[model samples]
Target: MTLVIKPLRKAVLPVAGLGTRFLPATKAMPKEMLPVVDRPLIQYAIDEARAAGIEEFCLITGRGKDSLIDYFDVAFELETTLRERNKLDALEALGPTSIEAGALSAVRQQEPLGLGHAIWCARSFIGDDPFAILLPDDVVKSDVPCLKQLVDVYNQTGGNVLAVTEVPREHTNRYGILKTGEDDGRLVEVKGLVEKPKPEDAPSNLSIIGRYILTADVMPHLSKLERGAGGEVQLTDAMAKVIGHAPFHGLRYEGRRFDCGNKVGYLEAQIAFSIDRPDLGDAVRAFLKNYTG
Candidate 1:
């Protein structure tokens, strides 16, 4: 028998959540539209997806999130003004933000369901191909984009690829923890997944992060729409259904992951990203000195 692995081309970004954690800041805007340094959190996720050779993207959005749909659309009026003013630098900056022709799509998640339901809303856009699901909340800064790392593994292993990181045993109750069957440093055989299990009953410290490269077959399981974990449709529950039948593995990606979902993490991401910028690094570093006084 011969093995055939499809080239990963499409990515789904679930950005529909009401950013209740951020309160008034998110009261009017989607949390994804929140800036990290110069760019919004969603932009970083898009840049990463593009770097991973993704040709198309499906954005799962909710009410008050139309800004995301407008973000990538060509700003004809803005472009016209910039062109007339000969602002070539500003024009060039927009190049990376442009999604491929007919490749950008936005699907609405009618309800404030869980992550699994959010992903299911994009099923029509997913069709029947191997695709990636990237959560904008987890902004990973890496020489090799996090999703690209998993795609490379999927190329060699040919099944499901989940980007994972080791969490503290005490923190296991907060995330989908993985039980490893074999350890190979960067890659490990996924024996089982326990969603937010108590610290003592946890199998391993390996916890699933926001990045995922799932095969099309997993959609059917999600279609069942069974509620799990927090009484909401859990993506972990759907993924667990296909555990034994698929080639699932957790990869310890080499990167600095910033959880932009929470307040502290969001502030940290701003500082971290600012430090990486050539123009802003010096000014930001200088500002940090005044805080000691």
Candidate 2:
């Protein structure tokens, strides 16, 4: 049977977590708003989605996340000040921050359920369409946007695709592990998925990261709200249910992923991103050399 692939147009970003890990700083501000170099962490995810041809965005938000919305809105006062000061570069920088009126929307996840539940909150926006899900916590740096790599693979395979990477076998419990069928260096056939499995129970080291291209069929499973690992509705479990029904596969995306939900990873992303920036690279490199030396 020839599989038909939908043109990927929409992306859902689950930003409802309280970010308990980054407390104090995140106490008042949403972790998604934290600055990595200059732009906020969530902006990187949005930028990546746009690069992958995503036209509409749904932010599954929670309380205290009004700033995420504000970040995308035109800052009349700020823009006016920049214009008056003739700061053309500064004004230009804000361009990407604006979205067309109907291109973006937000839905509140009133409760802090699991990832599955947060995604389910966007059902209305995702009705009857295959969509992409990007977790802002997993900030990836790549020459080709990580989600685009998955989109390319999805175009060829026409089923659910996930961004996966090999993790240390001993640390398999930290991620959703993949059970494989075929062996291609860049893409692996996903026969099964296990969430936070112990090393002994883990099928393989290939861990599912934050990027996913899922079929609309998975929504029915998510709607069931079955709680799995951590006693929360596990998206992994729902996705696993679709394995036998779809052309499920995992792409070993070309990128460096930083777990920005944690302090260490967040700090690492800051330095890594700063060192890659044209405006900050030289000064950051010098500071690093002086500090390390």
Candidate 3:
């Protein structure tokens, strides 16, 4: 029997966290709306998904997250001002911010449950097809976007696919670790998934990260609403149950990833992104040298 794989047209972005780590700044704005260079963290994730051919996007949001929802809306007044000023560059720059009517949806996660719960909140929008899940805090910079890399892997392996990067075994407690049945450098066949296991008990140092292309069947597991580590409905728990049913593989990305949710990580993303921008690179490098000296 030829395995059937449906086209992935929708993506889910779980942005409901309180972002307590970046408080004060985050207190007034959603962390997803936090600017990395010029574009907000969530926008980068959305752009990556759009580049992968996802036509519709669903954001799992929460209170104080109105800014994230509004980011995709058309700024008629701003556009008019730019038009009148003949700021062609600024006007064209706004083009990507225009999400087509009915193409984007934002659902509220009433409770601050867990990542799995936030994802489950968007179930109605997901329907039956497989969808991608991206965590905005984990900003991955790639020549070919990280999510796009995973989408290509999903096309080849119809089962659930997620991005993974190897970490030290001592640090396995920091991430969900994977057990393997087969391995080839970029793609590894997943035999098991353990959420933050102790170093001695962890099956492998290969750890699952933020990007995921999950099949619809995983919804039932999420529906169970079972609380796991951290006393929350963990996404890892749901994914663990999904292992034997079909092919599950961890894909190592060809890119650099930054954890933009914390202060140090956020600063790192700003510097990394700035150093790559033509307008800011030279000045930023000069400033860095003087500061270091």
Candidate that would win on lDDT: 2
lDDT of 3 at 230: 81
Question: Candidate 3 lDDT, tens digit per residue, 1-293?
Answer: 78888899999999989888988878888888888888889889889999998999999988888888787999999999999999999899888887999999999999988999998998899888899998988999889999999989989889899899989989999889999878988899999988889999999999988999999889999998999888989899899898999879999999999989789989999999999999999999999998898
* Candidate 1 wrong stretches, greater than 4 Å: none
Sequence-dependent TM-score of model 2: 0.98
Locate the minimum summed-lDDT window of 10 residues in model 3.
62-71
Roughly what TM-score does model 3 have, to 2 decimal places?
A: 0.98
For residues 1-293, write the lDDT of model 2, one tens digit per residue: 77888899999999998999998889999999998988898899999999999999999999889999989998999999999999999999999899878899999999888999998999999998999999999999999999999999889988899999999999999899999999789889999999999999999999999999999889999999999999999899999999989899999988799999899999999999999889899999999988798
* Model 2: lDDT of residue 155: 90
Q: Write the per-residue lDDT of candidate 1 for residues 1-293, one digit (tens) a residue.
A: 66778889999999999999999989989999998887899999999999889999999998889999898988888888999999999988887777767999999999977999998888998888999999999999889999999989999988898999988899999999888888889899998888899999999999999999998888998898998888888998888888887789999999999999999998988888898899899999999899966
TM-score of each: 0.97, 0.98, 0.98
lDDT of each: 0.90, 0.93, 0.91
Model 3, CA-based lDDT: 0.91
